[model samples]
Target: MSGPKEELGEQRDSTKKKKKKKKKTESGKKRREKQQEEEGVKGGGGGEEEEEEEGEKQQVEEEEVHSSDCIVLRGIFKLGKKSHDVLLTRTRLTWTPITPEMPTGEACVLQPGVMPLQDVFAVKVKRRRAAGQESGGPVLGVTLFCSRQRGRRLEEDTLHLHNASAEHTYTWYNTLKELVSGFSSRPKCLKVFINPSSHKKEAVHIYREHVAPLFKMADVSTDITVTEKKGHALSVMKECKLDEFDGVVCVGGDGSVAEVCHALVLRAQLDADSPEKPVKPVLPLGIIPAGSTNVVSCSVHGVRDPVTAALHIILGHQQQVDMCSFSSLGQLVCFGFSAMFGFGGQSLARAEKKRWMPSSQRREYALVKTLARLKPEYCHLSFIPVTKTTRDLFGHHSEDEDLDQDPGSVDAEGEGTWTTIKGLYLNISVMSIPCLSPHAPRGLAPNTSLANGSASLIAVGNTSRSEFIKHLKRYSSSSGQFSFSFVETHTVTAVRIRPRSQRSWSEEESEGEEGDSKTTPIIQTEGATFPWNIDGELVEIANEVLIRVHPRLITLYGEDMDEAESTVSCSCI
Candidate 1:
């Protein structure tokens, strides 16, 4: 094919020929006739319509020929070195020239008709150096792109026509095909951020010794950044160049995962041009477990093994998982699991406070201390169930229950419900996995899916002290029995905790008395500090605390858990 420079030169020569023809037609007689005809049509509307039609045709041709970056397939005919062939469709423009040797940009006479789809044309390479210079360059390879029908001509003569059964065909090329061929390139590497300061420092070592090797095998490069302080991992993620790598991997527990999720959500929001824009700049996340609780990792991928998690990273599968955002005292926090207030809050707060002790020691201590001091406390809570209200009211919803609700439904009170939980432990969970109890095979909220729109809440009501002890025992024993049914999703708008003035209950109050209605009871809504649990971490709040669930407010990578094993709600999960 002629280069653009050569084609321009040919056009100049053609313009010169046109000028010569105009000079020859400069006679007064011919010019006068043309003027007379133009004057005759000047007053008519038909003449203007004809001109407009011609202009429209030219625009259509330009649009069709130059729609995308134009590429034309061409070939050499004279002194052909190889038997090159071309095939083209009716939708394609194709032709052959009569002269075998035309100067690069000079046009040759068309061969009177379009070339057959099976026709073959020989191509030659013409490498050109800079103007006023001469040098050899790389030779370009040219091949014919033909339909299967045309290519089949080489095998059998009967395959010439589109549906010909007996005819053979040959391939041909007429114009350069504009095709992009770089979309399938493999990811160069991954950027891994590990939080060593998390619950346990084993995460960094675990990822280095176990996870890195597998990613290397999969040809994913790695840039490891170990966090040193709280929110350090999230900071790195926010500052990192997201496009430099294929994906991001986090090694640590739920807190670390929460950090990553928050950063990602913020980044996503920043990258989007409008609030209404669907997710635009999402980067997939991989999780490696290295914390006191690897809830997010465990829920997404069935196993907690660091090596197994790393393998999932190597596989490079991505999923959109649900993350709940909570607003407490105007401060927003995104948690992979539920948040707690009241008794559940107190229990988790106590458990986390003991983390300074060794794991075995802490577990033993928590178990013994909780049992010895088993007691039931009560708090009036306002909850808005994310699921159906009727099912959530009586708690017929089991741990394995599946229900559907609006994806964006936040009721007038935000699906609110009110109840008084009796036990000392108050829990709110945005669970994504089954089997929260370490020792028991049973999951407190089995139906909770990773990307589900709603959260699973299993709160122990104000039951007897013995009952509370049994519920606590279930966490460390496989056979401990406790009812952990799914209830209407609950959000803690505000909780009022009142401790009983007298530590012990009065027998007279227990019996139905005439003054029972007037009696205020020992507990009053005053002078009490309530410890709260957010994803198993404890924080102390004043007498009243307010919380609300932000549905699908954050995003994470939800690993594939087979359909036979679990289900999701409203596609959020």
Candidate 2:
């Protein structure tokens, strides 16, 4: 046994060792905290895209939000064997490599990688799984998945943040979960309608292979309905408890998507118990183009790709869109985005009669056949115009076009003058969206915004057949087809077009048998019925239709982009 002096000396030396170790640990922690306080993370330098708020334009400057106030939690994390300083900010998750200062006075540079919070749809825990085990094992780190724009399309990228401490691993996971799940616009539950008879009849495969996996990765719950018949999607949507989902998604063509949209509008009216006053749908709609004609998807998203559409939905990209209410004979026909009368209606009508032929071939045949028998229709047109923007040539504006307030009443301020005309017209169109496609790259209504409080009423006056073909060919341009003297374009809020009786024809044509009527189709049926193409779906309504433009009545998943670079042209002509 040692003496009391020796024991006291050993105790003092052990106490000194403990103090030194504690001082070193606390100094390293304080150093990290000071670095975080002084040098906050840098952001990705890309310019922020504009966000459409309600119906107004607003810049979101998603990159300018990085500051001390924006930092949520940060620490040292590892990427492979190298260490990195990681930060979770209010708007971004950024990381930079950590390199110690050299003793030789050499300079070192740090480059950080960043991902905006809006683009990061999911964060999951990485675990090491034993053989034949799918559930639990030793904890690894965290994995974050981001959807970003690559060239003309959106692509998915991943980042693995390797950390060994299980407590910190869970702490980062919980923080990210609370932050990402707190986005009010991000859909947590979805009601999806899949049309089995889409373009190639591959809607199921597209969803399972391309769309559903992303939804699963994002932890979004879904209720999917596979449509069986022509109106199956509409019927199913009508009966569905819509409030149970965050949004509605339709995987189909423009026509099917249009039908789904109409169903949603009608459902809203039914729920509101007021069909007379058109009500906006509470849920935003997502369109996955799996069809031959994807006008709505192409026009809104600038591309007709399913993967891009799905990613937009996952990332919560949303914009308001205007809608049209077509009321004829004191009855609401349906709601749509676009409508066509006269020659445009005639082409679609002929195409409908030849459904046995393939879709492309049938359209070509209808175009050729309609051109063979092209004739002018006598009509009276009336419109209430909206004020023109700088981009528009002729715009008539109304002072009482508030989206939240009822658009039924007109205000005394800047009330538009009602314009009326009676003439022989070749074609007429009412469009709220630009109706962009590969054939019409600049859109059929190039000057129109997706949520502008007006619609474009394009009226083609009577012209020679060759001249009319030239006007039709102009759709494949970077502007609206308004070059001809016969083409009249007006930005209007309300339009009433009535087809006049053709006194030039005999009563035998009107009182003829069904076979004769079918063989010799009337150019414009007077008061009895008239063919109109509403969002690619053919609708026949008698007398006149009152088409009123409702601004920001529906929400869609997309952003505003420049007119698509059209590479395809119409060979049907």
Candidate 3:
């Protein structure tokens, strides 16, 4: 769209044309004498150079008046084989065709174009001669701006600014380079981990094709490592020089990302000598979704596209996310953003055993198989709930008025005591960030947030198989899955789960349809290990475990939570 600058340009052109017509009406000798008198008054009897300089300054002021941002530079340049008037502002670069002075500058039929400075990552100047040669080709050169599109998705785009003086072109290039460099969030270098075995083993190809080119255009250096085996990323992270890179890039599924996150958290703790009170990671992380279920990437970037992820990294945009530390046997087990026990854990465990199959098919098989054998885990659970309280003569009246204010705020703390419940639960999920994905567009835990210093604790009590299935279906389309009668939801700072091990629990209550082999009654044995799914990785623990929520513990390259929009495609639920 045309801006005030265009209107002003047109008006300025019209005013000049009127002055020319008026001057033509006067005799040549009279015009020169009138100019000499005006120059004397305006320039204080100085030479023509003084008058010309004053006119240039006035023209610049006119251009400045039409823009809100500080005018950086202005010049005449060629774009698309046509000369145009170009204006650079602190926030954007704009250009318009320099049409002949007719009725007004608005008489120009072509529309103007603008490119936001934030999207421009790099700039380069073109020269006439070879780099090694003593001389160059033309006095004027074109400067190419390497930038990306701004929208739901980001794609690489370029613009060229041509000018008469190569020196001016170089100045434009340098000014743009300095501006792009001033964006402190944009990463200049990254340490990337690509899991070659993730999903159908396409992560390496995705990084090379979709991610590497963007990083190259942005001049973002990378120290890449193609993981050779499981836990390789974590192991390498421990040994690498952390100070050399600005951030870590994980190119795989949530499991691979989780492993790297866990490693970084642990490394930070080790370096700080504060294992008890761990600080946030030194470097932020970027996720490139190349797995079957890109849950973490989907939640952070709102899409599973690798190109979008690469753009976010190059731009250095970030979202401070909460991290969950799962502790068992009185020590840290691992760190993750979300976790699921009972039904979820069992399904993941089943899928882990079927690694020979494609990730999608294995997940589907595990889900179906687990659904058929859905049984509750009898356990003791305790949590410190977030509450809304106020000063009262007797007591507080309602929920915290700020409960709905900012989801990123720490859940009301120390206002209430720990609450405990002992029962048979089918599925329990703890989420710090909304686990957004194609299957759950609203997120698995919509009540929680990325940096809220709290987690959503959802406990699903035992119900008939069909009723549980109906509840699960809600996740495919909405966040009302917790609204079921048998489900209990809480916003809490911590959760402690102690499964009743060595207890034989009969599954007679779970079977709603008789005669089906999948619904047949089964008996449990002693000393059984409970399965846990922490960030898509399965773990087997027979003892009590504590899951604690730490606020803003790690930064991930992404947009803010409010702008995070996920697309729902899979109806697998």
For each candidate, what TM-score against the reference?
0.52, 0.78, 0.76
Worst 10 residues of 2 by lDDT: 396-405
Best by TM-score: 2
Residue pairs in clash, model 3: 10-105, 128-137, 129-137
RMSD of 1: 19.6
lDDT of 2 by residue, 1-573 (tens): 579989999988986896677677876756766776678844322222222252243223443433523889998888888999998987778888998878897758877888778888899999999889989887889988888787557888888999878899999999988888878888999999998887678888989999999999999999999987877877887789988999999999888888888898888988999867778899999999888768888877888788889988888889899999988877777788999998887688777776668878888888887788788777777777675322125442212111122235453434555566777777889999988887787788876879988999888878789988988888887654787667778889888898885442224334632333464332233444667888887776567888989898889988765565466675877
Ordered from best to worst TM-score, the candidate numbers read 2, 3, 1
Q: How does candidate 2 fare on TM-score?
A: 0.78
RMSD of each: 19.6, 14.6, 15.3
Please state the error at residue 318 of candidate 3 in Å: 1.4
- For candidate 1, lDDT tens digit of each residue in 64-91? 7675324333333322332223333433
Q: In model 3, what is the error at residue 267, expressed in angstroms?
A: 1.2
- Order the candidates by lDDT, highest first — what do you get? 2, 3, 1
Against the unseen true structure, what C-alpha lDDT does each candidate score?
0.48, 0.79, 0.76
Candidate 1 at 237: error in angstroms? 2.7
Ten-residue stretch with the least lDDT total in model 1 = 151-160
Q: Summarize candidate 3's per-residue lDDT along 1-573 as a digit string, tens digits.
A: 579989999988986886787667557646667788878843232354487799999999988865648778898888878888888888888898877766754564677888888887767666567668876576555555444645556767778776767678878878888888888888988999999878889999999999898788788999999998777887898789999989999999988999999989988988889888767898999999988777788878877789888888888889999998888877778899998988898778667766768777788888888888787877777776766421121222122111222223342554345566777788889898888877777788888778888998888878889989888888776556766667777788788888874543212322532433132111111332576888887676667888888899999998754334445543455
